[model samples]
Target: MSIQSGQSAIEILGPEQPESAAILSAQALQLVEELAERFNVRRDELLQLRLEKQAQIDNGKLPDFLPETASIRNSDWQILGIPADLQDRRVEITGPVERKMVINALNADVKVFMADFEDSLAPAWDKVVQGQANLRDAIRREIDFTHPTTGKSYALRPDPAVLIARVRGLHLDEVHLHWQGRPIAGALVDFGLYFFHNYQQLLDNGSGPYFYVPKLQSHLEARWWAEVFAYTEERFGLQPGTIKATCLIETLPAVFEMDEILYELRNNIVGLNCGRWDYIFSYIKTLRNHSDRVLPDRQAVTMEKPFLNAYSRLLIRTCHRRGALAMGGMAAFIPAKDPAKQEWVLNKVHADKELEAKNGHDGTWVAHPGLADTAMAVMDQYIGELPNQMAISRDSDAPISAQELLEPCQGEATEAGMRANIRIAVQYIEAWISGNGCVPIYGLMEDAATAEISRASIWQWIKHGTHLDNGQLVTVQLFEKMLLEELVTVREELGEARYENGRFGEASELFRSLTSAKELTDFLTLPGYQILTQKTVA
Candidate 1:
């Protein structure tokens, strides 16, 4: 199928769906094609710069504040004023754009709901188009869902949470949509479709189009987005800053350039979020070649770790000083069924939010609706009736240095941790390839970021030949042994019929290849997308 965009055509490789016409209309395709043609070359350049920077890190140069951007960092500047709907974001819930998940997330008692098309979504072609339709219906108050099995019904409440759409990262490509004989940037397709279809309705309802930009590695990337926003606003004859964005400071190099990033998008950005899970993954990937910087078990690297704590504190300081909201990280724990276990989960969430609140964060993210109240209560206690804690600049605190932000966490990898990593990565990858992304596993919400950490940590450990706490050395042979044992354990946990029906074989093979490769794979999704596309074709 092909759609005309001016004189050009966008070739659609995926099977057509009922919502395809409405979401992928000629006008929307035009916007996507224009954005891709104008900005994709710069996106390619920035991605190449990432590899160059990684080469420097591999050669022993640690990341630090840029000397060139010192003027912007030292000079006083502020992001444009945040809109009223986004002011009281004490608690925000996030999920994929599946129909039921969309309805439930928006109706939850939170200040905002980030409808994600990025990490939490599997990005199947049908799901991607259907997700756009779902969000458009939701914005117009026409979306509802009926459970296929339980016969339950769901509809949006009277005043739903504020909606923010997160587009895909620069590194991903929407292979199903080709422009000029190449795949369009996934980021453009997500942003262009959502913005084109819903901006007017959102503005009519007194909320302009809002967004969450993910996986950026530099200020130049931020500038690329800023230019896109400016061009879109001008094209639509809307006011400048009509599209407010909150960028995720998830990459290790981005932490050092927070001020610069905010400055580049100052007119269109409202805040910066601590995308902690991806940040940890970035920590490992950026320092994969540094023997002394090896991290311990994933569980051991908590927010209280010196490097993570320094990152949080510095983000708070920098954002508050520059008049941008400093949002906290995710509370990934899902409530357990058992009463005692549920209490323990809530307590962990409470403690985590308390740390973020005390450190002067204006908001936090929760993966489950069950967690929203707990996160909100903690933020309320610290912020009182205030919309946010922006007034608390943390000016009196000691400056966080590069060494602290890069501090090597002190702990040893355990056999249990390694086993758990193998299990989670395999199971999550299986689910992802099966067209589900947000999954509940072992009482935690597991998404692409956590799965990346799981596999990447093991790769880093094996690459460095580190010793586990059990006095076992990490090697390809040991990893393979554990892989087989873990599969057996998983097979027993899940019955034979279910195991046979699932995609564990493919998942395990992919995981094994990733962890045993000569160098760490940048993202498992890069390879996993191939499997997904092949499965779709078959």
Candidate 2:
């Protein structure tokens, strides 16, 4: 199956399907083409700037608050008033935009559901296009699902949670959709397809075309999105603030420019989210060359760490100062079925959300629907009868210094943690390459962000010749040995037939190459994506 270019510059390399027809219609492709033609060059420039900034960091020029943007930070400006539907996002549940997951997430007891096309999603062509189709049906209230085995059904209940689409970051490309012989930016493809197909429907449903912009490393990247939003709004004859967005302050550099990011998108922006997993991954990647800044085991690097805490506090302070909602990070725990383990999961979630609410955050995120009630209860305890804690201006708190924001966390990297990292990364990459982005491994919902941390931590440890808790130095040979053992263990758990049929062999090779690379790879997905496309095209 194929789509004719139909005189448009964009070409669809992905196989055509009945469901993708409406999503990749000529008009929709036009919007994507125009957006790419207009903004793709700037996107390239900004991504290159990211590399240059990393080089600077590598050369001992650590990130600090920009003096030029100091005036923006010091100014007492508030973003435009958040829309009514966005005002009370006390508990937002996030998942990939699959049909059943979409229905379940919206029907959950949360206030908002972020339909993700970013980290939680592996951008295989069918999934990407079908996700847009699923969202289209969801907005129109025409979506439903039936379990193939039990014939159980799922559908949205009355007054479902508000839906916000999260587009891909700037660093990714939609290899399926090419304009002028090069792949278009994945963000534009997602934003354009979703906005073109659903904006009017969403508006008719009394909700704006909302978004969650991810992995923005600087205010300039934020500015690019602002311009795109403005162009889209005007092109469609919509009002200036008709398209609302919540930027994820998920990168190390973005923590410093929260104020400036909000300032740039003030007209259309409503809040900022603590995308903690990616932020942790960003912390390691951004400072990979700084041996002193090496992070401990992923489990040990909780939000309680001083640097992470400072980041949350600063985001809350910055967003609230400007009348924007200060959203919290994700509680990625998937509630265990075992009563005792579920108790522990809920307890952990409660403490995490409690910290966020007490820190003046207006809302928080949970990965699973089962954890919503626990998170909601905590938010209610702290912010009862309030739509949001925007009024909680933390002016009295001590100013968080740049030093605190960049402070190295202290903990041990144990052999157990190393083995866990190896297992998680290998299994996640296997799942990702097989077109499943979200997987439950060892009782937790693992996504691309967590997998990233796992692999990046290993790379950073090996790069710096760090020692494990047992006093064994981290070396490529050590990692290989553990990886081989973990694969055998995984095979035993998965059974021989399943292991042989699975992409564990490919996944293991990729993970090994990533950890053994001379330079830290930008994203595991980039390499994983190449594999996915190769398989899809074959």
Name the weakest run of 10 consecutive residues (lDDT summed) in model 2: 1-10
In candidate 1, stretches whose alpha carbon ends up further than 4 angstroms from where it belongs are 1-8, 535-538
> Which residue pairs clash in candidate 1?
none
What digit string (tens of lDDT, one per residue) describes model 2 on residues 338-396?
99999999999999999999999999999999999999999999999989998898999
Overall lDDT per candidate, in order of appearance? 0.93, 0.94
Query: What's the lDDT for residue 33 in model 2?
Result: 90
Q: What's the CA error at residue 279 for candidate 1, in Å?
A: 0.4
lDDT of 1 by residue, 281-337 (tens): 999999999999999999999999999999999999999998889999999999899
